[model samples]
Target: MFFSKKKNKWILAAVVIILLLVIAYTGEKRERLTFPEEIVMYLVAPAQDLFTSLGQNIQTFFASISQYREIKEENERLRQKVSRVQEEMVDMEEIRQENRRFRDMLDFKEKQEMELLAAGVVARDPTRWFDTLTLNRGYRHGVEVEMAVITHRGVVGMVSSVSANSSQVLLVTNPRLRISAMSQDSRDPVLGFVEGRTDQREHLRVKMDHMPPEAEIKPGDVIVTSNIGTIFPGGIYVGEVREVDVDMFGLVKYATIEPSVNFNRLEEVFIVTSPVQEEPRQEEHSADGEDVPEES
Candidate 1:
């Protein structure tokens, strides 16, 4: 009870002090309790400084957040741009490799001893089964009928027909195409012709005819052109012997040849021009006639 009484007395004293302060403020005639200018400065200046510092700190925090977001967004954009450029660089490298391969084919054609004409494969036979192609070069390019065409790999075909600016080539795989070929090791010649067979299911197959009975023909033997016909040059690589068979009669032997040039995938070819003979011609005289000297 004594403690409670003391608490009530303290509250009453606080109320009285507050009422007096209110009355003094309202009564203008009463002398106001004034503090010196120096004392006012000491009381209010610290509070103002605290409020100003809080506002400045809040602004700086927000600006820093905004700057971080901008930097993150820019980093993402730059990464995407770099990835796109890398993909384009890969595509350019592929194109460069393809161009190099085409240039190598051109160089091989240039190095050949034969007089050559270059032509691109423009079109293939509509009858997809036919081993034939149309060339961009023709009569206008001095491409003549029956001229042999070859790629860097090996023989491709012979010119079958010609238009003004285009020509048709009968591929080596064509059934009508025949070539005299011989083994590189023995130089023993054989006659081979393309056969349109479905067996062994390959790009091309040649039926070798008139293989001598005594000749030892084997698989993996390289076959090249012989001087039997005027169509292709002698010693031009044609194919390799893949298989051999002797008929029941035992009189004739046959072999299968795999062409060195893939007709189904030919892209470009070279046409060989006829070689000019530089030697002078010789003349013969009758028995009674005097030998006539040829003019210089």
Candidate 2:
């Protein structure tokens, strides 16, 4: 076994010496590579080319992945930016609509006979839903109890209670409120008292009671305050006649009226002040002893 190991070592040394001699001889040559060297180079060339190409392909793939990630991040950022812009547009549109409504109200006030005091609705009577809403104005602003409150569409209510800074309005949609209503048509000559209906919720409607049997009430007929109306001003729009009903005796008739004012969407109102009739008052004071100003 020892002699065999010694023989293997000598064979390895001989191979190393032969490789050294071949390298030295090749280094001195200026001519083309020898046939053996050419064959060796040919065998390794394809592997070297494959390794260089694989490195280039790997670098390209990594670069493409990084670029795609950047694009995805940029797209997400753009989507968020668009969403914010749409939200802002919606808010601006809402503001624009509010301004338009206010403008229409201003125009309506200009057409009124009495001085109109514009006010915003601030609260509602919890027990009655939209039957009663509170206004930002009160006695201090010349808003008196029983004064008619109106909107651009039509009459809304009467000021039922008053405070220094706020007042409550009894909406016409309330069951308690009754107004003498008349048909706008000169031919029909329909007259009745209007009262609010509570059973329905979709639309604010009123009952026109004690309609005359001969009265020819019809749908789409515009109703207005009659001359008999004491609280509300005459000719103020009330509602449109919807359905007509007759009693079993055929002596009395009633009709349903769709109110012109949309109480559900009430946001603002104008209080109608009566014309000053009495001799100029000496001083203005509320029943509660708070000094107030006279209507201008």
Candidate 3:
């Protein structure tokens, strides 16, 4: 067994010496590889190529992940910027509309015979929004109870209650409020008292009651306040007659009126602090054929 081991060691030394001699001879000038070198290269080349390809694939995967994260962040930033721009646009439009409304009110205030105090609607009765509104002005601002509330278009309501800094208005759509009104027609003027409909709590409508039996009131006839009321100013627009009906006893006639003011969209109004006596002028049309409130 010892001799066998010795023989194997000598054979290994001999093979090493022969490999060194072959490398020294071919290192400078070699046309082709030896058979043993060719066999070794053939076995190692495929494994080397596989490892290199795997390294390149890992680098490419990491690069794609980084690029995707950057793209996602950029999109989120752009979305926020767009949202901010849209909000700014809406704010600008709202300011423009408010300025226009103020200009119209100023024009009306310049032409009025009564003392007009501008007030903003601050609150609304949630349970009776159509019936009542609260204003920012009160007795401190010359706003008093029973003072008529109006808009550029026409009459709105009456100040029902007052406080130090705020006041409540009883809208014309409320059943408890009443206004003495008359037809605007000069040739066939009819007299009646206008009051809100009891059954129309959800709707904004008023009825002119106590019409004469021979009253020829019809639709499209404009209604205005009469001098009979001590609270409401005379000649102020109330509404237009929508339809007429006979009483159950047929002894009197009544008419439904569509108010000139849109209560739902009321934001600002003028409170009549003091009014002077004036004759009701006939309703007129503008050059554009639009019905305009005749200035008193």
Best by lDDT: 3
Q: Quote the positional error of residue 205 for candidate 1 in Å.
A: 2.3
Clashes in each model (backbone N, CA, C under 3 Å)?
0, 0, 0
**Each prediction's TM-score versus the true structure:** 0.60, 0.67, 0.68
Candidate 1 colliding pairs, count: 0
In model 1, the runs with Cα more than 4 Å from the true position are 1-94, 187-203, 275-296
Q: Of the pair 2 and 3, which is ahead by lDDT?
A: 3
TM-score ranking of the models:
3, 2, 1
Q: Which pairs in model 3 have colliding backbones?
A: none
Instruction: Please tell me which model should have the higher lDDT, number 1 or number 3.
Output: 3
Q: Against the unseen true structure, what C-alpha lDDT does each candidate score?
A: 0.70, 0.77, 0.81
lDDT of 2 by residue, 1-296 (tens): 54379888798889999999988898895679878889988999999899999999998899879799898999999999999989989988988988988999988888877778999989876666557999999888888887778888887977878999899987887766666678897585787777777676633788777777878888888888765544566678888888888989998998888889877778888888874333323332222455322111
TM-score (C-alpha) between model 2 and the true structure: 0.67
> What pairs collide in candidate 1?
none
| Top candidate when judged by TM-score against the true structure | 3
Better of 1 and 2 by lDDT: 2
Provide C-alpha RMSD values for all models, in order. 15.4, 10.8, 10.8
lDDT of 3 by residue, 27-56 (tens): 857789889888989999999899999999
Tell me the TM-score of model 1: 0.60
